[model samples]
Target: MRIQRIQAIAISLPLIKPVKMSFEEVRNAENVLARIETDNGITGWGEAASAPTMTGETQGSMVAAIRHLADKLEGLPADDIPAAMHRAGQYLYGNNSAKAAIEMALFDALGQARGKPVYELLGGAKRMRVPALRLIGTGSTAGDIAETQKRLAEGYVAIKIKVGVDTPEADAERARAVAASVKDDKVLICTDANQGWTPDEAIRFVKGIADTRIEFFEQPVAAHDVAGMARVAAASRVKIGVDEGLHSLDDLRHHHQLKAALGASLKTIKLGGLQAVHDAALLCEELVMKVNLACKIAEAGIASAGLMHLAAAIPSVDWGVSLSSPYLADDIVAEPIALSGGYINVPTGPGLGIRVDETKVRRYTREV
Candidate 1:
C-alpha cells in the first residue's frame, strides 16, 4: 500500500515517580510520536524520544522533518521501508528521531499487513519472556540501600545503580552500600557512571570495589573516549558496558576493534529504530559480545514495545533488558503492558500486539 499521510504529535506525560539518574532527574516524559497512514487505510504508530545533545534531534525538529518529507513519502509503498528511509535521509541532514519514528511506524504497518507481530517480521521469537532490571538512581548510601532493598522485595533480582554523580569516594561508597544491601551474590548488580568519570578515576573507583560483586560498569568515561575506555576496561575489575559511546553499527564495530567494552547497551532511539537495533544485535553476536536492550527514561510506548520484541528475538541479550516499565502515571495505551516477576511477556497480537488508545493519546498530545 502506498503512503497517504504522515502525522507527528508531541506529548508530555507525568511520571508516576520521578526517576533520578546520575546525569539528571526526570519528572515528566517528553516524547515525539509519529503515525503513518497508507492509502489503503492502514495506520501504524512509532515513538522517538530524543536527547538533542546525544541524538542531535529535538521533538520540534523531528515533527518538522517528518512534515517536510511527507511529499516524498506520500506515494511510496509501505513495504519499501529501507528505500523510503534512504529517500528521507537524502532530503534531511540528521534527525535520527524523525527517521526512527517514521521507520518504526512503517515496520508496524508491514507487520499488520502481514498478519504478524514485528518480531516475527524481524526473524522470530527466541525467548517467550525477557527478564528486566530496575535501575536505582543516585542517592545517599542509606537511601540507595533502602531503594535497592525495596526493589528486591518487589521481586526484582537484578538492579542497576546510578553512580558518577559525585566524587570517586562518594560514588564508591554508594556502590559499596548497594552491593552490600543484597544478601545473595546471585542477585546481579551493575553501575552506570553515565560517562561521568575519567579513565584513571574509573579504574580506581572500580578497583576499590573489587571485593564487591558488581556485574559490570557502564560508560565509565566520556562517550567519545575510546582509548580511555579501552584503558579502563583493561584495568578495571568489573566488566565494561559501553552505552553513550556506541550509538550505531559503526560505533559498535569501532568499540569491538578497540576492545573498549565487554557489553553494549543498545537504545532504539540511539541506534535509530528496530532495524538498526537488530543490525547492532547481529554485529554484537558476530563480535561475540553481549548486548542489553536498554531504554531512555521515558514512558512505555512504541519504543518499549519495539525493544520488548527485539529483546525476545535476540538470544545473546544475556544481560537482560532495561526497558522503561509501564509504571508511569500516563501511558498512551489503554491496558498497561504486563510485567510479572521482573519480566515482560511478549505481545502475541498482530503488529506491535499492544493496541494504542487513540483517545488517551490525544488527551496527552501537545500538538494536533
Candidate 2:
C-alpha cells in the first residue's frame, strides 16, 4: 500500500504523580502522535513524548515538525520505511522525536499489512519477556527506601534511584539505604543523575557509595562533556552509564574510545526511532556495553508497546527495561500493557498489538 495521509495530534495526559528529576519535575505527559493512512484504507499510529530537557523538542515543536515532514513523506511507499526516513532527514534535521513518531506509525502499518508483530519486522524476537525496572524517588531518603522495599515485595528485579537533587553525600546516603533494603543480591540497583552534577560532585557521590551494591551510575555530568564523564568514570568503582550524552552511534563510539561509560540507556526519542535504537543495541553488543531500554518519564501505551517490541528483539538488556505507561494515570490504548510480577510480555499480534482508543485519544488531545 502507498502512503495517503498523515496527521499530528498533541495531547496532555496526567501522571500518577510528579516525577522529580534534577532539571525539572514532570507533572503531566506532553506528547505528540502521528496518524498515517494508506491508500488501501489501513491506518497506523505512532507516538513520541515531548522531552524538552533531553531532546530539545517540545509538544508544539514536535507537532510542527511532523506537519512539515508529512508533506515530504506523502505518496512515498508505506513499506519503504528506511527510504521514507532518509527523505525526512534530507528535508529536516535533528528532530528525532518527531521523526520517531512518524517512523513508528509506518512500522505499525507495515506489520499489519504483513500479518506479523512489530518485533518480527525488527529482526524477530530474541526473548518474549523482560524485567520492568521500577523508579524510586519519593523526595526523601526514608520515603525512597520505603518505596524500594515495596517494589521488591512486588517482584521488581530492577530499580532506579533518582539522585542529583541534593548534595552528593546526601544522595549517596539515600542510595545506600535503598540498596541495603533490597535483600536479593540479584536485584539490579541503578541511579541516574540526568546531567545534574559537576564532575567533582559526581565523583564524590560515587566514592560515597563505594561500599554499596549499586550496579551503575548514569549521566552524572553534563551531556556535552565527554571528558568530564571520563573523569567521573575513572574515579568511580561503580560502572558509569550515558543517557543524555548519547544521540547517535558516533556518540557511542566516542564514549567507548574515551572510556567514558560502561553502558547506556537507549530511548527512541533520543535516537530517532526503533531502527536507530536497534542499531545502537548491536553496537553496544560489539563494545560489550550493557543496555537499558526505556520510554521517557511518561508515555502512553503506544510508545510503551513500541518499547516492548524493542526489548524483545534487542540482543541484551542487562540493565532492564523501563516502560513508562505504568506511571500514567490513564492510557490511550484500549488494553494498556500491564506489568505482571515486575515483568512485561511482548505483544504478539499484528502491528503494535494493542488497539488505540480514538475516543480516549480525543479526550486527552489538546491544542498545541
Q: What is the C-alpha lDDT of each candidate?
A: 0.82, 0.95
TM-score, one value per model: 0.96, 0.99
Across 241-267, the per-residue lDDT of candidate 1 in tens digits comes to 999897778999888899999889988
The runs of at least 3 residues in candidate 2 whose Cα sits more than 4 Å from the true structure, single-residue gaps closed, are none
In order, how many clashes per candidate? 0, 0
Residue 111, model 2: lDDT of 93
Model 2: colliding residue pairs: none
lDDT of 2 by residue, 1-368 (tens): 88899999998999999998898999999999999999988899999999988889999999999999998899999999999999999999999999999999999999999999999999999999999999888899999988888888888899999999999999999899989988899999999999999999999999999989999999999999999999999999999999999999999999999999999999999999999999999999999999999999898999999999999899999998999999999999999998899999999989999899999999999998
| lDDT score for residue 87 of model 1 | 90
Model 1 Cα RMSD, Å? 1.6
Off by over 4 Å in 1: none
